[model samples]
Target: MAVGSVALAGTVSGGEFANPHLCQKGQQLLLYFRTIYGKQILAGYNVYPHTPDDYQQTGRHAAIWGRDIQWLGDVDEVIAHVQRHGYILTLHWHWFFGGDSAWTRERKTPVVLDQLLKPGTPEHDTLMRELSKTADVLEKLQQAGIVVLWRPLHEIDGGWFWWTDLQHPENTAELWRVMFRYFTEERKLNNLIWVYSAGVGDLKKKPPEWRRRFYPGDQYVDIAGIDIYGVDLQQDETPYWDYFRAMEEICPGKTLALCECDAIPNPDKMVAGKTPCWLYALPWWGCPHPRRSVDWARFTMGHPQVITLDELPLFDDASYAPELGILRPADDGGAWFPNSVPVIEGFVAGRGSPVDLLQFLVDDKVVAEIRHPPRDFSWTWPGDLHGTFELTARAYDAAGKQNLSNRIHIAVGVRNAARSRSVRASSGTNPEAAVDGSYYSGWHAAKDAEDAWIEVDLGSPVEISQVNLIWGWKIHPAKFAVEISRSAPDDSERSWETVSLLEDLPWQPWKATHRVRFAPRIARAVRVHAYQRAAHQTWAGYDLAEIEIPIPAR
Candidate 1:
């Protein structure tokens, strides 16, 4: 339940805003944008369910409920806030039932839509009960005068969720139809404006018939939308535009939208071309958060054609067209911006390539070149390399044309197991597992062990430059200290010095590799001491996928 701010109000009944009775208020709002598509676009922002009310101060025209709203206990409060703010509410459901049954407790295993769609099964009954409960909540909101843009089972072209099955299109299509019928007809929830959304990949790969394969039908859908991210926005947007064309062919006259995007589309670029007919755009909630820049919001919100909350007409106003004016055609043909540079996607581990390559480079200098390279290859650096380096790849065809890939910047220290003679953990299964150079295997402290340590013997005194630690699947030390010990050969004198102290490390379910570089020092042994585990860890112990200690090549 993410939120955004606006400064306007409106009232309306079904279809008046769009087809005058065929569509609901929410649908009308979408159609209103369609009517003015080429001339104007609407700016929307998502709100987290728990985000403070002041979050609405951003002056966005529309508000989206974050994916987590499906599981939240305070949905009523979220709806009330949207109504109070006079925002056109849109809801995205990231159903968690597919992953964990413990969260819902209605089933013994994860919910499978294919099985649940079949009647008379326990799974089907449980899912229906759960969905009915949600419908009951939305029914109350409708009774209270809230019309929602309901986007469920979104991104069905992606395989990330149970509701999506790109390979089994028929199954996903049936699942969608079942849900739509159950909600619209069986439950009698008419206040919702159904939005049919597919991942950008669906639009890109599927043939023209792909639209028909997953479409529930125009009667069940009011808007055709897609979710896009900016990670590769600059590289290509053909699929984005293709979606608009597909929707026009499949559900002509229905409004098209950028339902979810990490970055807002450039207004000038979007409106310039035979504009792709995007009626509105809703950027995901975190775009303007600490990690992302507010430039996206600033640009879209300031665009002349973008409708902000303050500029929106009352929903029931019949004279809104006079205020908005007619759509205008583009002055010039749109320019296509495509990346001319070679695109690259691959990663290197330590100092080597994980896949075969025609050429490997470090800092734009070709270091290795292979003819008839294998599917995978590795190249050793000048072992003494201890700082950051940029790596790139180049492949050549028989015609001698060169194709370059994106550059990957990586530090060249922390080689695991090479210098480590023996490793010992204070208390754990397979103490030496951390140095085994396998992500699947790791050193695990005893179940009850809170504070733990893993010491590595380098066999002899060496100049240690950096230490890298990879966290395992379950547990990660939130607070830890890396220490170095320099001891005399006779074992008579020893001194331990803290080399690095890390606190408040974030916990992640997947393995994350972190490297810590320090001033070169001479030490016989190095140790990592864990002070605490991240809160999400199921066990009170320390776990590490791998430990690396790289000594400078002398």
Candidate 2:
């Protein structure tokens, strides 16, 4: 089938899936991919059996895809299972029959691409039957109001698949075109958003050649996706950036995605690196090993940029204005101090109409309202509120329609005392490290040091209500005292007084934070004296990750 012959009449405009709304003029798949852009990214999970019902049970991903459908009964059943949830569905086909019969030892060499493409050949007939079965399922889904992010012949640039070992790279492209024609023209499956995906490893092994060789052309693809693994997921390594940029240069106008990842990328690193173009990421599932921990999952999914399954909108609602989406004091990362005013911020992506007003809600009650809100809106909470609270924002369009944003869970308490403070140690140590705003880096005292002392300069005389200390590995203090002083440590007129004393502090295998609240004291400097060191398996000196002091409201 000629690629040009396929009519574009029923092709779903990629723009329809862009933005927070169903159908608005914006970047394609931006709603699902870059919902938080610079600040957050969307989280997705792939499950075994690939059924929508099973995915719903996990309650993790905003988008779901499946592989190994044969193991889950039938392809149509899997499609039906996924269609029920109306999720952003992606499908992966592991073509084991390419050449080596790894699944079965019966076939060693798969038929050549030329033979498979030729009419009246046994290989051609066999391949057609398989394609017809998939197309049949997709046709049913199309009739049922489902659009699939269909990724067939994936990882074809890698040598592991039969399709990848074709005599020439053009042969693989031909195979892709054949499959595209069969699904779109022969079977009339317009609900598919064709994705041209390749493995990052193959791109590295083959370099620039692999991208050009395997590409099926812009006319045949809507999104360019890459499968990445076996690297540090915590950092945005060079390989990922290379492939991301290559896809943009190679495909030019198509959207980009992380088709399959063994380790989810760190949200902070992704944002810091400025590669927010990733529309969505689907991490391969099989816990406690290649998959990330529950903490990592929670952090990524709860980020502002990431849209989980529960957060995604119904396909039918894409044409309307999206419900308000919270932008600040992130759901999981946000914290408020007791007796301190906390500001809540969010925005509604108005679909064609202007937003008339925005109402900020605390525990379902309207706390603040803004008329004719700007592109973004914010409201400050009453300072007296304490304990845990839930926050949400609602927006009203010009027509008076209302929509609510996601809920943010926050705790009102004494803020971190050590943040944004200058520190000095009595004896030589990396005192400044403790206040650097990172858990991995901390202040370390001299080896076997005893009676170690660290002092913090608040830069001004402020009322302090609490002191929080975070201990590093095998370096907790057994006894400590918090002291306050009005003058510099070296000043002859300086007066120091103990404000809080802690004894017999417990040790933890992992770093832990200990909070101590005291009667509010006004001072310019605070000191922590370690009277004794806990029995250490390694070093006996003190090590502190952070020192937090919360100032009470006036």
Question: Which candidate has the highest lDDT of all?
Answer: 2
lDDT of 1 by residue, 19-41 (tens): 23333455545555555666666
Give TM-scores for every candidate, taking all chains together and pairing residue i with residue i.
0.51, 0.51
After superposing candidate 2, which stretches have Cα over 4 Å from the reference?
A: 1-40, 49-59, 68-80, 96-107, 202-204, 274-276, 317-554
Scored by lDDT, model 1 comes in at 0.59
For candidate 2, write residues 1-554 as lDDT tens digits. Answer: 01111111222445443111222211233333443343444456676621112111122445455454334356567665564444566777765453345222345675577788888998889788878876776677666666667788887676566677445888888889889877766676766767788766655557765567778777787678788877676665676788787777767766678888874577666757644447668787533222454346555655655655445544343323434566566432225455556676654544434678888777788877888887556677766676455667777778665667765555475454556688889675679887765544578887767788898988878777667676655677778898899886567899888988888777664344566677877888998888877665344467786676655323
Ten contiguous residues minimizing lDDT sum, candidate 2: 1-10
lDDT of each: 0.59, 0.63
Q: Give candidate 1's error at residue 489 in angstroms.
A: 36
What TM-score does candidate 2 get on C-alpha atoms? 0.51
